[model samples]
Target: MTDSGQFNSELMAFLDASPTPFHAVQSMQQRLQQAGFVRLDESQPWQLQPAGRYFTTRNGSSLIAFVRGTAALPEGGLRLIGAHTDSPCLMIKPHADLYAHGYHQLSVEVYGGALLNPWFDRDLSIAGRIVVSADGQLRSRLIDFKRPMAVIPSLAIHLDREANSDRTINPQNDIKPILLQGGDSSLQAIIAEQFMAADEQLVDYELSLYDCAGATLSGADSQFISSARLDNLLSCFVGLQSLLASDASHTAVLVCNDHEEVGSVSAVGADGPFLQAVLGRICGDQLDSALATSLLLSCDNAHALHPNFPAVHDAAHLPQLNGGPVIKTNVKQRYASNALGAALVKQLAGRCGVPLQSFVARNDMGCGSTIGPISAAKLGVNTLDIGIPQLAMHSARELTGASDPLRLVTLLTAFINSVAPLCVIAD
Candidate 1:
């Protein structure tokens, strides 16, 4: 078992290093390589061996890492854990250059369901993938400004008296971040300078503004973690740690998809063919048999009961900070948790001696979904939705109990190592 303090320190470093999905995948790939997992190229033929550790990525964003167990895959099946890498943020527009009133700014589009108010007046930086035409060939590279380069200042109260109560943000008119005062710098020039590509031509790019501040242990007793992209990144870290710690007796897979904050319909997203393609290659002729005994745990942060907004949550289903992992369920099938799947998690939690909680939105409020249902439908596997309870989800900065992530890691590690059959027989 990992020490709580050590686990959180490593997690904070990961959050600080990964500002976008590309960076997150890169960071995870490096860690996997260090742990002896061989990287596989999608275009090349694979020669998998029993007990071999391997991983592959799609679009430099989504990733799938697995360990082929000594046991037959069709008999023991796969222990799968799923999470996403993308988060809600302000994405740079193609025509990003804007100048008004002697101020240079960049036009940005709101990506996903972001809490706009918190984004105001925050020190922000840019990081993402950029395509460059260098040496007479096109190449894709990741870049990060690595410093506070811009800010979105809020309108003064004198300008909008109702700013506190009924203020509305126009994505087009209000959110352009100020880059400099009376500067002649173009976005392309800035990118070239950052990349040191003096002779290369900037072809295209995908960039997003992120909070310059890094993750930290917060609260008086340092009981909570405050950071950006904790919604799913936290799950990704936990899944990776659990996979790394597995005993390798059973097949274990960790998949981190991209674009979940949006509708997850992209080529590298959960709704796409990424995971299916990987599974088909791994299982081959026994794909159906393997899926019948496999289980997927979709881990995404759940909304914790907020003390200041208690009325917004169902009284009976109020998940608490540091209370343990939460099993999310919805009758409408927004989440993929069924009775059998939920029961399996419960049994696992009990065996691991980890506390557990349940969450259901207020009767009048609609519930959100995760990759659980999508993966289950795509592969015909039993899946459950679970996550650590969190506060201010989709905000520029989010919060979760410092201990909950470690608790989840413990449970998932057990699940990956367990040799028992993962299915329940229905009478």
Candidate 2:
């Protein structure tokens, strides 16, 4: 296959492999480790040196990996790129058991800004964290109940005459997915048996409901990708591939955190101390300067204006498919990009002859945010938010530029390979 075809295959494989946030982090860890990156455990002391590759994970959902620069700790700082693993879905709630009209269902709370209507009548499955009893020991595992499992079917328009004109979902009542058709199909029992923890109590869970439908490449020429959870996972895959492929003298870092859709406040989220802790351990005492000159590219999917909804977007700055990576900005600071970060990316894109675009949400319309500001503040580093323009963000299936991921990987490779001097004294 050609390079583009190869990339498409790889991307589809990635999406298929990463069904949940936990799975995403695991896939990244495996890739980096295969590329010769040593795993670093924070519980143990870090003895970082130049020319080494190291990484660490948090709560099995967030990850931070960095390549040590050949030069000494730079007074400037590290080059960091960030993205998120989590997406909008329905999460199973604690005390999740429920039965209605002899139908078994799981209580669920909506996570993030989910387009609830699209989720209805879809082949939904359960995925995320689960604790098991293994040989009398409790262990946590991520599982995808990978089947045509549950669904929250919408009421027929004929039954609810005004369904099209006025319909709102009630997370507690209307959105509970129909899991089974019998007297307690023993959903919990099945989970316990699979986990080998039938004897143990179901202490807790953070499972999310996901569409089991596979992502596909459509169009006569296969120019379009349609799938769930593409809003940010596409960026995660691009960043991971770029970071692993990079052979730069300077350090290249990729951070994938969970909970980005729902305020990002979890322990494994960008708002948490995951990135900072990893960086601090890696840089040791020289972390001061290592953070000063550091820059981050917050990679997430940006909104592409839809022809049908042209009025919602800015008339002057319309982003098209395959246009290239977008440099996102918000006057209200929803995005963390500043003059310096924008200039640097643009200059680098120019130097590499790669096309670049810009995105600014209409002033009247509110904006969505990424992990950029959170990381910048946590590490005191400069950051820019960037992405490939996409349509159907947060929908059951999203669309993006066919060649955008490759373009982004190219620009990121350039950034990682570019050199900056570092001055330091070994402690």
Best by TM-score: 1
**Candidate 2 lDDT over residue span 1-427, tens digit each:** 1277788778877887777888888888888888899998888988877778888888888888888876555643577889999888788887777888888888888889988788889888888888756456777877887887788888888899988788887766788888887775666776776654445766567788888888788777777777778878888888887777666577778888888998888788888877777776767788887766778999998888798989998888888777889999887778999888888888889987779888888878898999988777777777899998889888877887677788888888778777642222236
Cα deviation of 347, candidate 2, in Å: 1.6
What does the lDDT read for residue 343 in candidate 1?
87
lDDT of 1 by residue, 208-308 (tens): 99999999999999999999999889999999999999788998999999989898898999999999999989889988999999899999999999999
TM-score of 2: 0.94
Worst 10 residues of 2 by lDDT: 418-427
- Give residue 356's lDDT in candidate 2 (0 to 100): 83
Poorly placed runs, candidate 1 (over 4 Å)? none
Best by lDDT: 1
* TM-scores of the models, in the order given: 0.99, 0.94
